[model samples]
Target: MIKTKTLFTKLFLSYSMIIFLSFTLFGLVFIYIFHLNLYDDYEELYDFHYERLQEQIAQSAEEGWSDEETADLIQPSLHHRNYNIFIYDNTGELFIQPEGDAEYEPDQEIILTASDEFVSEGATMNGNLSYIIADSFSVPGNEETYVAVMVFHDLNHQYQQMALMVLIPFIITIAFSGGIIYFISQKITAPLRHMNEAALQLATGDFSRRVTVSSRDEIGQLGDTFNYMAEELNSLEKMRKEFIANVSHDLRSPLTSMKGFIVALLDGTIPENKRDHYYLLMKEETERVIQLVNDTLDMSRLEAGQIEIAPAPYNLTRQLQRIAVLLEPQLERKGVGIQLEPEDTDLFVVADKDRIEQALVNLLHNALQFSLNGETIRIQLETTGDMLAVHVQDEGKGIPEAQLKHIWERFYKGEKSRTGKGGTGIGLSIVKSIMELHKTEITVKSKLGQGTVFTFQLPLKK
Candidate 1:
């Protein structure tokens, strides 16, 4: 169904046109530059021979030499190059002629024109046809002026045969060149044609569409790049569908709870003595909905490159301590404790402090979500070369290896926590975005029964 097939057609037609124009240009060059006009060269050669012979005959003429005797003197030498001459008088009587189809005469105008000074017609003759050139010449002052005419025979036809011999091969070459052009154009445009079809499928929301790459040339590279784009687009499309479904489910929870609380209160099911408790719970649900919306907006802004990181020097160790203190209540409720490595120490780092704080809180909260009772979540700091590494380790039901790659995706509730965990499912995604803003990445190491560790790096303050 791909209708945009013009690239091949355009390439084919353009290459053919270029080849055709090249052929025409080469033909002109061959004719003009390479001495292919044999007809004119032959005619000029005959004229030169006639001039030399006539000069000899005029200089060698004797008293009372008949016109016929002059003709015999100027007769064709052996191995004639297909040319002859004639002599005549002013009355237009032919005194001498050549062996040919003999129905010719000298015109009276040519006879009169040559009476005083020598005159000759220089017009080119037709193919193999003979013509007359009348001129009367006498050596200086002798009263014996005779009309002489030279005839060129078969030179034009001979030139035509030579040209035909060359042109037949040239025509064959042009035809062969057309075939070569057709194949080359197809080979060049083949990938583009496939890409066009794939692109059309992409337009119809078929992100799985891909092109075949057969070579390492530019066209093949383009095909490989297109397939990569399609794969990423397909992943994004899946994420889009998942995000919509999760948002609907998350919104329905808070909304349904609020609706239930309202129905109970309006019908006096929640008694006046217990109304305050129900009101507090409804407010909490409303706050949860607001937090969900804000988190989605935060992810959106981060992904759209709208949130610029404002980095500065900060005490990273102090920041981690403060985050642990702020989460003291949640840690207490979960029966988990936070322990800082090499306690009572401080280290400085350069980063966006507020964003880093957000990341730490999210990681700690995630640990609190899955940590068993009486488990100690450890926060460690180490320096290696130019950067400082921070690790958050927890004694929790660790993520599956297959699920680890997806933990940072929005709404990715892995198999372990998907059933029991009460999370908005974007906490790790926000943490990942924050680390990316610092020009680094967060990595996780975990096993099925063991705990998980989340590690990232920050630029140490110099």
Candidate 2:
């Protein structure tokens, strides 16, 4: 992958090149178009006078004027018009080169007609490119008289100066626009650089790192999303660390107790009269360890999508009653009562029987765990439209509003300390996964002082 600094450089240089190219192309096209549109007027004016001069020479010959008189008639006008006039006689000899030292020549010569115009490209005395426009007309005695005009490229030279005049602004505009593009590129790459830094921190297990976001554009939204992801990862990391500590305590305490009990039994420190009680205590500790491992494995499997649910019709109300019976011992120990609301009715629902059973066991266990003595946990059933809804509501110490949302996350027991209780922490997550596999959702409604009602619905069998 390319470094962010290199990426910024690429963006800056690419934008600068585009702006530079655009200005260069625009300047060139503007000058070329202006040159073509304004080019021909000077040449046309010179050709007009050459033809008129031909007519004047013809009239002078008819009236029998002398060469000196003819020269006196048109000499000043010819110099003012910047023309080098020529006259060719019948034999095609060098007839008259007026303005005697005019070092100019037309590359070709031709006879004249009413609409005849001849233009030849030639060079001036200083070797600069020039144009010669020539015309000939008939005079007295069947003489062939031609007039040639030489005009240097001073117009094109003026166009060159004009191009230079426009070029200064173009260079200045390109430089200014390049600066603006660099600023915009900085704005674009700054957020990405921050995100890259945060990502590196994240890779190093620093989930607390976050990017600053301010704009409302797509980049801003990306920054916002990155920060949100970091928050969630921080939360999950916290949960993971807590879970590890809890699991460690849970395993170590049980194993330590079991080991102590075994050592006592092996050494006969536990009297024969109390050996049975010690054995039972050890067995209970072993069961706790087994339960913790099983719950952890179940959560992993569910999250990995390794557990597939098979939906079939089952009596949901009867299942709830069975769960109540199975948890009767815990209820009795807590002096709690399990009551089923409208228990006489049968509700058939489409769900995986084993998965639903697993889910009900967890919910009832949780409800009983938080419950106080003489508190009744109500298992309510009803047909809501096309589905049968089962609500396991508990009269225990209700969960706080803040922790209610995270109840279904793995190892997220809001109160954290579950001393003297049997909870593997991922029970609610397993239940939620089971419900989701049945194409349904488990929802909770609770207040801090009031109670919590866990509700889940399954499709009713028709």
Candidate 3:
């Protein structure tokens, strides 16, 4: 469909054709008027010459001149004009032809004749090479006689001059008009050409490609809009990839754990009395699935801007103490010591207490999972400037460099860090999302063989 006539081509053809036809019509009208005016001027000049010859004929006749004498009078006048003049009697008989006006020599009997009704006005003859203007009057000396006065003006030279004047300008006008059309067409089509190329790139899945727009015109605005659409599609594609990876990992871990325990029981690896232990393991896998579903629901709510945060002044120290006490049983079972260090005063921040407590629990749980037995997990609360920060430091085999950045991503657990019964892997992602909704930030600092520290900061109350 795009291969058919496009907008630019249609507009170009429409405008160019309009210009061409308009200039052509103007040129033709101008030349036609010029030719008509020149012909009218030539007629006026011929009338003047005819009137002068009539006066000369009347004067010679009043002088009682003979035919030869009248011929002498007319010859000089006709010579000055380079015109052919003649006179005819009333009868259709031979009359006098002016000297040098006949085909024969001057001494020859040049018998010029005319009909009784004399010809007048101008007439073109001899293929329009000559124009004859004739006027007739009664001779004053002989009342019974009428004579014809005629002038023949050669028009070949005038015709050639007019043709050149009209033809040369027309040729020049056409050449100039064609050059203007070509230059303007190129200027208009250049930007459209670039837009065409950008569209092709988009079709081929190059969402990163964008058209460069330099003006605020319609075409430029179109380029900007296209670029914006490309950027949006690129962002959506990245989100799709992240979601797929997270979902795949989330589903695989629990299935693997459930399968292993079920197979052990079926193969009688455990005695009948110990079969209850396998059931507990299967129950744990079911709980991981439940936790994963709940975390996904919370994430959806946060992203859709539907989760309302209930903010109030909360004792930051009390929440920290509560988390340490709740996780003490698990910490002691792993032989990991829990320590809570407080500031000079009870640090307070404006936040939802329940949500903050949940986030702290997730952090402490993550720390305890990686810590070895006999290692210490330190929990600290401090105020710096206008913010209260909580730090959970675990002296365990710390997160490796490759896995540090991905800890907060959903269902992301390094191969070596995956314990058979540890977590749903969405705990840290939920914590990160909750902190973001509260306008707080969380960060991690860790090194291989050292310990890992996860810290979160919130706005301190006045």
lDDT for model 2, please.
0.76
Residue pairs in steric clash, candidate 1?
A: none
- Off by more than 4 A, model 2: 1-5, 47-55, 58-104, 109-150, 273-276, 417-424
Q: Give the best candidate by lDDT.
A: 2
State how far residue 131 of model 1 sits from its true place (Å).
12
Model 3 is weakest, by summed lDDT over 10 consecutive residues, at: 104-113
| Model 3, span 123-153: residue lDDT tens | 4454555544444555455564544444445
The runs of at least 3 residues in candidate 1 whose Cα sits more than 4 Å from the true structure, single-residue gaps closed, are: 1-5, 33-67, 78-82, 85-122, 125-191, 208-217, 271-280, 384-387, 400-425, 460-462
> Could you list the CA RMSD of all candidates, in the order they appear?
5.7, 4.1, 11.3
Looking at model 1, residue 367 earns an lDDT score of: 80
lDDT of 2 by residue, 1-462 (tens): 655457788998888888878888887888887765544655676667666776677777888888778767766555533445555544454445557535654433442321165554444545554545555455556446554554444544666677887788888887898889889988898999999999999999999899999798999999999999999899888888878888998899999999999899899899999999888888878987987898899889999999998888988888878888877766887899988988899888888999899888888888877878888889888888997788899886688777888888887867443224534468899998988888888899987656789998889998
What is the overall TM-score of model 3 with all chains considered together? 0.49
Write one digit per residue (lDDT tens) for candidate 1, span 347-370: 889999999998888888788777
Which residue window of length 10 is worst by lDDT in model 2?
Answer: 106-115
Clashing residue pairs found in predicted model 3: none
For model 1, what is the alpha-carbon lDDT of residue 195? 92
| lDDT at residue 159 of model 2 (Cα atoms) | 68
lDDT of each: 0.75, 0.76, 0.69
Q: How many residue pairs clash in all the candidates, one count each?
A: 0, 0, 0
